[model samples]
Target: MLHTSLYCRSFPSPSHLRSLVLSSRLFPSVAVRTSPTLSLRRSRANRSIAMAATEDNRIKRIASSIRVIPDWPKPGVMFQDITTLLLDPLAFKDSIDLFVERYKDKGITVVAGVEARGFIFGPPIALAIGAKFVPMRKPNKLPGEVISEEYSLEYGTDVMEMHVGAVQSGDRVLVIDDLIATGGTLCAAIRLLERVGAEVVESACVIELPELKGRERLGDRPLFVLIKAKGV
Candidate 1:
């Protein structure tokens, strides 16, 4: 459970609220307004169509900011680099604001960020929502008693570690990363949180490579991503 102290903060101001509402309007599938005459299914379908259109526009902005390098780390690989996105303040803020608006009132008590890139996006969200930030680190990065999970990689397996007391039982957690390629890293973070009795509310990323089929590997856990790049 979140501390009562965290609940005392005021909601967003009217202008901020308008911005948040506008952002939701951009993703209508997730924010359909109720209508007395409309059937639930019809409303949902309308929202889905609106969401697709809005998401396409948003993806264009996000995708443009990213730099794609062909065969960088290895042959036949196209790396989507977010460092270019960071260079554009508005794009970077849009990425973070989208997450903040979605999770601000979600009752998320903790934000668990996967090692490096997650570290960049997770803290701002944690601060905005008054949630505690927990780092899911590489093995030995955390200087404390830790629990580690070994996950498969393309060529081999690697381990991620977290501090023993970073999360409490029943904490509602959101996992954040810059991107999802193979899904193994996010899965490892989810396993670590669930192992400690924390309820993982969702896993989020700025970008997703759907070709990798990472979402299928998450089982029932929901994945929310801003942009999906079909190829690179």
Candidate 2:
């Protein structure tokens, strides 16, 4: 199914062969022995390249599993839909595995999921790492006394609320959501967590809309995302 062509050239003598090999950057070590440090560096570089290729493959599979709907809810809106991804067991598991393996030993005590979509990915990650899952709801949807932060939306502004004791002071937290667009919702979630003296470890999302420059909106908070795409 695939073919690679090989080209050959003649070397008049052994000296000519050595000169040709030395002249080519690809055959740097062919003509002479390399230092141990140089050999180690080359080995590390090769391993890194192989690891990067594997990561790229995983990203492609997760991206392909998602569905894109054009002009969704309103015209001019390209929605990155993940319900299709959830239906594919392998893709969905792989997506979650990336997050779980990264934070399993990071000492994340609380995993906060933002509103509706966050509810989907947060629990499994928390369960995997033995962390508690807390829901950051909207308005008075959460019972009892709640902390609220109003964030700017594309159209207007909305409030995100959290229960009084969901996250304790000095608790380490990892914020979770399905996607990050303008980053308003995630920033609000961060504000709520910090107001209680909790340490916002990092934020994680499955998809990101780089065109919106949302990652820049988070300031110093580290935002980890799997797939980067436009109009999503």
Candidate 3:
């Protein structure tokens, strides 16, 4: 089904053949054989296009389903609410699929979710990624011996705690939160994970407030946001 030009030249000396093998090892990917075939190239191109379209559709659906509240907790703050999206089965299913696709093979041993809202999305992500789910709660909320981290918030200072034995040493963890504001709560979660000798593979959120500079406090870590708010 494919045809490629094969040039036959004079046989190379033993030393030259060894050098040629060395070159193949040096640039393995580039050295892969390519058979000239229009149909094969077209198939590859079509696969790429289909993948891009699927991803685009997923993003569009998620962005559209997210409803905007002019002032949720207070005036002057437009809250991006995901309850509407969760209510729709299709949208919620897609949301879970997206998270699973991103981290399924990333060696996630546990998923740590912040208190309250994070619980809604955390369990499913853990199941999809084949990892255990651990809840980080407010002070005195967890019934067991917890490793706690204290951080300052916009309203005041608060602390979040996690059970000490929930995650094991060197375990890979993924932190999930519904939204990113000042990153105070998330920073505390990260501290607790490290204190227990767990490595946080990444942090993800459905929405992010970029104007708040939450990413700055996270330091050089992989932070992923499905959508970004317009401004502060």
Candidate 4:
């Protein structure tokens, strides 16, 4: 005679089975293992947080590379000098990478750089993003026919010029500069671009002095900056 062991297996109740079906339909991706899905979400969140922290550290490193000179141009003036940043290869590359990462997917067709410092940051970004670089220069700097925007200075008015055909109507533009002090130069750059029928997507700077309220002067246009400098 042969004997077999009797075992009992439990099956889900009809209501329980219906609830499971509804849950599967509502959350198909999470039907496998709830714990695993939650763990995956936590992992992704951790990765995002780590990426953000790394980017913050990079910005801090770039900002620290800039040397501040006190009373060089005049008394009671603190000037942020980016020459030191250029001297450090890593810092300069970080600066460019920061801008490129932000603007790469922004549909920017033109990179408009303001006079001197903007030229330094603009070319690298333009090349990285495959956009045309247009120089906003001082009077008589460009040999071609140009449009000029005049902005008031401390004592008088100055002008910024851009070539006539450099930017066309409906072109998306990004304006670049090293620093924003009084917002005069950037305002003029925006005006010049808008006058030519190009849309100024945003203005970017490496350092921003919030006390100067340069962003307020920009009105509806957005501004991006890596570092916000205090007491400058």
Candidate 5:
């Protein structure tokens, strides 16, 4: 005698039963399916969300206290003057915090700021991260045995100097600059650091000019920029 229990499935119809059996046999490994276009759309949506989050964080951190000056350094150069950002208490603090956060994990033995403008941001980051502050000065600025590297600027050429004994062998350094145009100054700073037996772990800047490919001269060294201007 056969024992029929509730577990025994009842067939809907002969034709329906046959169709189900044929489908199962033909495609036994079939799983959930979605069109390729749908998958692409989902991936794009995820990327957009990530990008938006990054942009929002940047906006909140970047000081809107900057002033725009029409051609103070040169004609037709709209300088994005940051004197206001420097004066404001909160903005200045935020700038230092951002730099410190970016380079905290870079194992920086020293923070080297290039020339005049770099002096503003570099020492603060060095203090915050517990690293020694090193200065990259102009020609004849520091009175000691020095190493110098020269490179061209947008309008002319300039040389940067550093004290020979500023960085010890096997030390890791981070170079900071206000802006990177053709990257001449930044490259010189890298060479100066390396000349004294220090390894430049990374370079940080406030702005990058992509059109000029300012970063290309340094090969694959890590670079970070807080903002990029238009046409770059």
Candidate 6:
């Protein structure tokens, strides 16, 4: 007997194809996920990636704000001028914010700033972290029983002075500076702080000259830098 129905098979309707079955042995691979753990993990991964991208963008913005002056102090020198960065409100605030964010919870008791440019960035950072600001000045700049450390420079040597009893024993100190060249100034600051029995938690700087190998002189002390660029 000829039967047309025997040759035909049923096809899934549009609604069935679009539906998500909680459990289906026939289509187990396409069944809806019963557990939320995988979803949560994926969500967390996405947020982490977004946060990293935001941080990178902020660093780029801060780096671009600095002006590069050619042959200013001498010939063949590419000076990184942060004064231009200061002109931009967002950039300057961002720079300070980055430093504060890192040390706010570190239990830093004192913020020791290297003379000149460090004065500009150090006080605000110190104030934000509720730490005392101690100025590491040039020779003869600080009054009243100051201790001095002489460090080697590219050509010769220079002296840095700090007030007596500024940072006492057991004080956790953070050294701040604008730029690091040959690491002479930062090493001197570290020595001065350690001499008074203070622990140099770490050093912070806005710019770094990697080509000069300043980090080599810094030794085991961790240095946090916002930007790495050649200034010579």
TM-score, each model? 0.76, 0.78, 0.81, 0.83, 0.71, 0.83
lDDT of each: 0.87, 0.90, 0.84, 0.88, 0.78, 0.89
Q: How many backbone clashes does candidate 4 have?
A: 0
Candidate 1: residue 130 lDDT (0-100): 97
lDDT for each residue of candidate 4 in 108-221, tens digit (9 for 90 to 100)? 999999989999999999999999999999999999999999999888999999889999999999999999977889999999999989999999999998998888888778
At residue 171, give the lDDT of candidate 3: 96
Model 5 lDDT on a 0 to 1 scale: 0.78
Error of 3 at 172 (Å): 0.3
lDDT string for model 5 (137-232, tens) is 988889999888988887788899988888898999999987777778889899888887889998998767676788897788788887776322
Q: After superposition, which runs of candidate 2 have C-alpha atoms over 4 Å from their true positions? A: 1-53
lDDT of 6 by residue, 165-231 (tens): 8899999999999998889899999999999899999999999999988999999999999999987
- Candidate 2, residue 129: lDDT: 97
Candidate 3 lDDT over residue span 1-232, tens digit each = 0111111123257675555556765534324355679769989999999988997898788888988888667887888888998988887787778888899999999999988878989999998878999999999988889888899988889999988899999999999998898888899899889998999999999889888889998999789888887433
Model 2 residue 154 CA deviation in Å = 1.8
Name the weakest run of 10 consecutive residues (lDDT summed) in model 6.
Answer: 1-10
Task: State the lDDT at 175 in candidate 5.
Answer: 95
**Could you give candidate 1's per-residue lDDT for residues 160-214 as a string of tens digits?**
9999989999999999999898799999999999999999999999989999989
Compared with the true structure, model 5 gives a TM-score of 0.71
Model 4 scores what on Cα lDDT? 0.88
Instruction: Please list the residue runs of candidate 4 whose C-alpha ends up more than 4 Å from where it truly belongs after superposition.
Output: 1-40
Query: In candidate 5, residue 57 scores what lDDT?
Result: 64
RMSD of each: 17.3, 9.8, 10.3, 7.3, 8.3, 6.5
Q: Which model scores highest in lDDT?
A: 2
lDDT of 2 by residue, 28-62 (tens): 43455679999999999999999789777878889
